[model samples]
Target: MSAENEVRQFIVAADDDGIRLDRWFKRHLEDVSFNIVSRWARTGQLRVDGARATPGDRLVQGQTIRVPPAEPVKPDTVKVKPDRPPLSDDQIAFMREMVIHQDASAIVLNKPPGLATQGGTKTHEHIDGLLDALQFDLEGRPKLVHRLDKDTSGALLIARTSRAAAFFSKSFSGRTAKKIYWALVMGVPEIEDGIIDLPLAKQPGTGGEKMHVDEKEGAPSRTRYRVIEAAGNKTAWVELQPFTGRTHQLRVHMAAIGHPIVGDGKYGLQEAFLTGGISRKMHLHARRIRIDHPDGGKLDATAELPSHFAESMKTLGFDLSLGDWIPLDDGPVPPTREQKKAMGRAHAKSVRKERRGERGRRRG
Candidate 1:
């Protein structure tokens, strides 16, 4: 078939299910750009099972995607290079030692605190750059499925293949993947176990990176926390289970409740520091993760606390003998597409109502 006339059809595999249409195109058709994809989607040139599709549409298994023909790639076109640099021998050895669990589909790493998951400006070394080392005679390098804060340590999931990556990514977005974190907070919560149902929005003027409680115009966020042990009301060992995966959700939520995680200078400020002999590292750790495997069965892994975290726990007389918490079934399920749309409409209506009420109060 001529390159200009070569229309293609693809069947969505189970691995690709729940991914956005634009992402699917980028993965399978690397030469395609977001602009081209968006243009096609807007002009009805892209169809899923004979129906026009949008870039934001989530694909499901066994659906047929009809891709319109496109111009042939020119041999002289500039190619995008891999963002990561080659790994050194020492870096390779370091990554290998961090592996806590490995299988054909995924690898779980006990990522240490201060090691960024992906490289950024001024970040010369990171797990993403060295993932090639974890290939270990495999067909392809592992891919990171999700991210933990640079200061947070523990179970970071790496998918061993494109198939595994898609599956795990969907699992996380669907909220089937459960994560439990352990944190040592500066103060204890008044309630031993309760939910923090606060809305969170990015604080402006901070490069939109820092989060703060903003109920009127914030995303709905919820977290379930339990105080496991307390050290004379000065510090407490807490387990945090976040139902929503908003950036800095756990840190901001804990701080909003007046029990900031120890050593969280950004959120906790002066209260983050402890005068006792405790290490000044962020006390939060990604203690455990449980998710359904792409190839059947379950994927469960737990990471041991980093040295500083363990030492602080011991010093505070918190029991390290308490094993990891089992995946909680009571956590909120992620809203489906219809549910999310309904929620968005409701939120818009509420915002309009609040604006009217504020105008009335101002006039009064």
Candidate 2:
């Protein structure tokens, strides 16, 4: 084979360490489409230290990656993404207004209701399209690490760099990131402070847009809720925390327990709506997010409520000062593998010592 067609190998560098295998290709091998990478991985042509590797696998510094020869691209057959239109001056201002917190590695936006996190069929105006306005002087556009439903407004995080994106993505997927939400439900839950441990799956015939509880064939889902205050037996103000990242998890769990979130007609049907000057918009709000930062320490951000949600809180006689007082966790960090191994050894030694002492007493 010619030199150009020969297989190639690349070593991970310090800067590229901890990034996903696919992200490495995007940074170094720009011509390699993700589909091509997936094909190579599936066919065992891609390897990390002689072991086949997938695109989502994390890369360590000094690891060697085996790559197959580049395939020729036909310009006529290649499909290209259409360029997005430039943001208008008003659009730029609107995005800027949503910025609640910004740092070197992340940007937190207070996404308002009626704005989609990402664009889909017939979805033109969305937070993803407006991301360019938040780029600032960065070398690359901000990347979304997680998403909130279009109508479920609250704090949304944007990663500033590829490294931050990988780190934040792992943090979210591993359930290490904690998010707090404030919502108004139709009625108070019978169990004031409870955990909704229900499996969820997409409702059939909904085109994967809606979710429901499924006992046999569904992914495990859990949500913790605490009622902050209740307005008689009619309405309730509650705090929600999701332990698993399932589609519409909080919404489905709340509705399954018979206290559908107020204004969530999709799940609650007719009972979700509230009268007496209450807005028909979804009352769910992402209040805060706490995750370990890529650059050490933690990135904790809080978003203020939109006008409608704030007004609803006032109407329900809920005090704003008491909303954020609850701490999500006061537990210790989980032990690492090495720490667990050492603990195991210590435990065995203790057991051995206790048995030996009993034997000595019996012999005496």
Best-matching candidate per lDDT: 2
TM-score of each: 0.82, 0.84
User: Candidate 2: where is the Cα deviation over 4 Å?
Assistant: 1-15, 33-57, 61-68, 330-364
Report the C-alpha lDDT of model 2 over 1-364, residue by residue, as the tens digit: 7977999999998657799899899889988999999999999999999999999998998999999999999889676769989999999999999998898889999999999999999998999998999889887889999999999999999988777887899899888999999999998888898878888999999999999998888887878899999999999999998888999999999999999999999999999988999999999999999999988999899999989999998998888888888998535434433467899999999999999999999999
- How do the residues 188-253 of candidate 1 rate in per-residue lDDT, one tens digit apiece? 888998878888899988888699999788888888898888889899998998888999999999
TM-score result, candidate 2 = 0.84
TM-score of 1: 0.82
